[model samples]
Target: MLRFFFVLSMITTASVSTSGLAQSSSVQTAVDKNFLELETAVVEAGATPIASIDHARLAKAEGVEMPASRVLIFSDPEINTPILEENVRAGLDLPFRVLSFDQDDRPQIAYTDSQFLKVRHGLNDTQALNTFESKLLEVLNGLDAAPAPTSELFADYGVIELRSQRSVPEAVERLSTAVMGQDDTVWFGEIDFATEASQQGVALPDTVLLLFGGPAPGGVAMAGFPAIGLDAFCQKLLVYANEEGGSVVIFNDIAALAELHYGSSAEPHHGLNKRLTSTFRTAIE
Candidate 1:
């Protein structure tokens, strides 16, 4: 019994050490990279970093504030402005609402937009949603309006996906650091991922921040589902970004939302195809 316990204790110690090392490594690497340009812009706008953002005006609909999770839906597919469409297609999904909460798990604000809401009614799988999310974030995270596509060899990203297995809070911090740079002017809205779950009537915790931005020039559009209907969305976000200099739109529970809309009775695949084709033409046209 003594021998067995000794072995077990050694194993436990090693495991703890490994876990700590991994976490420390993650933090160190994250600290080295740049991310959230929009958030930095908002702060540089001379507004308090934690100012009470007008979520209603930003999101264009009614939104609610909840604990660490909030959901804001963009329902309208047609109301997308040219800039919004390009940006959305470029991977800036037109955020329509924001839900903010406090560290004590208290509700803060629920803001929504009428013009931005458009029922997805499509996209049923995590794979599809992942592809969509990856494409959009690539553009938003770009230091320039046109950041090059990621390479597959990148530790956390490739041509289309930028994922970090780090904790949600940590990932957000890293992204925020990258974004809040000198001369970066923008605003941001925060919504909890749990808000998305609640909206879908499910229970899930996926931290996602939907970013919107100010306009300087129109960016190029890529192909695939990300390309579809994105022009409209991007146009809206860019306009918002240009006028306000930045916006913080939040999202949680991306998987649940993808499943809800994609699994619905509507022809999800067809919708995706149509959107993709339309995006291609819009970009070229």
Candidate 2:
């Protein structure tokens, strides 16, 4: 019995690599299916969904290595929701790609039409689209180089939205000037809930402030690669707020983490979480 068990274990081990990594095709298929499934659920839940794809896989499968970042944001509202459900169960994967830079000094993946098609179909193609793409690449590389948002940048054009019950002008004045260094700006709005609280009675404010930037009520901000953004933003907000009062409901749009690659809010790094908490502690105490 012992020899039989040992032989079985050996056979299993022989079929797997030492690193325990699944075959690239298997991993790729799994990821593609998972993302598609997630998209379907999100749409069925009545939320608008967007997908960001990595387009370097085609070249990689053909023995090429290239560095590319391409994300696709689209709306398929006209498609029946049931079609989406059928697609998920059928394991039909979206035509998408993956990107990575390698040590061989070549791009890990080659650019291909399938990848570009997703982007072309999704974008509005305004002249600014070119500028935006360039800016996004710069921001991603910058985060890899120096993981911290320039507060001064926020001081220049960043906006803040306060709750209706709170005084708006004062909040703006206090927050706008408080940001030091980078040229960031602040804009203000008020969220007003009606007495009856009907959806029509309550207007969703156009401007949202991520609490990680100022206060919690307006928008959620997060950390990590672009893929995990929503989760990271929500996590940091809860960490900073710590079940506190409503005074800090406004937010400043600190750049996404990809823009700030090196530091954190805690003492060792320059992140929004640490900076906001530090500011609050000094003010409250």
Candidate 3:
């Protein structure tokens, strides 16, 4: 119980409601000030600020080079609880993200559509999910924007379909224990999608997002290649009903993510990548 409280405090402190809480980099981008302005603006929009990771500073400190970058994750638990009640895996996209970056002197801001997040995970509780989309747009409009982006979110994810030998709760308990059993630390948080949805006057299949990881493995990988941190901070165990109504888990393959982040299969990351894939397999099987 103490461990759970510590993890919550750790993540939340990095994303306080007040402005100026962000850990930023010295490298400036044209759009940098916009994000600073957004910190306050996002609050006015009624969302809970989660955390912000400055990839540029994080990478530079680890002896790697990256463009000026910042990623912000925010949520309105009041809004999310109702939706997540119906679709637990929605947590994957919960606490939506807003990103700012400078490339070749041009600063740009980007965000993922909550709808797109559901599509990638194969969730279809459209009405409930739309609330997440709308809330995200509400926050984004409070700031500034570039042209509408056509790119998909989580394009690097390699999903796996595993037949669940145990129920969602059983799987989660097993996986959580496995995580703590690891020599290095790992932390996870779970959400009850079905119950949350039922409370919202909707029905959804039993679904869950078992999100867990630690800074050690992902951080080491980031030191090896900082860009991967953008996508690899945490890996998820998505337990949901497939078309047949049987339970299965869908997750992002670490090896695939390494390949995507490195842009063309860097053999150097093969070792960590394999270990990552193995870890997920052990939890589910």
Candidate 4:
């Protein structure tokens, strides 16, 4: 039995917008549970655990050494459906994830703060967001973990967007092919927001999300700070239809994200960022 201690840090005063929302975007929590234990807790809380990524194992396979780190992607449609109806962009951040990593020999867990999601997505449904927050808290509390003092690990969300002359579907297919064409890249899966919304009787513009990453760059990034895997390991590209019927493609800026997690934008990150930019640009063009 492996025992891990996670420090849960909730940002109470971090504000992303000047609208007085008074919410932060990220939270780190401490708990006495391992990765599997945490996954079970998520399922017991009635949320669906979609994927679990072991960053340490991936690094090992790539001949890189890193501390133990993993990320679990899960979702609760009941809590997210309403929010999605309000803002479909939230799909990029949805299927909530919790990261477990060993830092300084002390294991820790962190997750995206729902209140921050509310502001990030411009969601107006307070009740739905509150419910989402409570449901996450329920999972943590179920582990019998206590909250600790907050930390300043929060950073501004950064993404690069590209306009596509093609339609959303065609752009998504092209982007998928482009990503897979890259050396060492892996296409995890895609989420179609428009299809999901249509099933729920809500109309939304064509929106699709593509998740892909390679151990070479991703492992290299995590070798610096394993926690970065929570956000940067699984690279995401969101393709959506614009008002003009064309498509727009967006993805996380690796340089900005690397700086946010590793405290500086190193040369490796710059190279990776350029590579990603070129790949997306080629697909859309």
RMSD to truth, every model = 22.9, 21.3, 7.2, 11.2
lDDT of 2 by residue, 105-135 (tens): 2222211122122232232334433433333
Write one digit per residue (lDDT tens) for candidate 1, span 1-285: 000000000101223357645653343223222222334433443222322232212222223221122222332122222222323222233333232222222223222212122212122334434443343343334332221121211221111122333454555444444433313223334334334434545433333443422211111111111111122122221111222222232221222222332222224333433443343223222
User: Could you estimate the TM-score for every candidate?
Assistant: 0.27, 0.26, 0.64, 0.80
- Greater TM-score among 2 and 3 belongs to 3
List the lowest-lDDT window of 10 residues for candidate 1: 1-10
Kindly report which residue pairs in candidate 3 clash with one another: 85-193, 85-196, 85-197, 86-197
lDDT of 3: 0.56
Judged by lDDT against the true structure, how good is candidate 4?
0.68
Q: Pick out the ten consecutive residues of candidate 3 with the lowest summed lDDT.
A: 1-10
Q: What is the overall TM-score of model 3 with all chains considered together?
A: 0.64
Tens digits of per-residue lDDT for model 4, 1-285: 011122221223343674322211221223224666878888889887666666666655767766667777776766666777787667667767777776655577777667556655667788988898888787776443322111322322566778978999899888888888877775566777677667777778898877667776787866666666776768877788889989988777766665655567767667777888898888888
Question: lDDT tens digits, residues 1-285, model 3?
Answer: 011111221111133453322222322534457666666667888875655556555444445455565656665655666555545555555556676665444566766565555655565667767787777677677555542222434532455556756666666676678767876544544555555556656676776665555554555554444444434554556676656544676665555555544454455345555665576567767
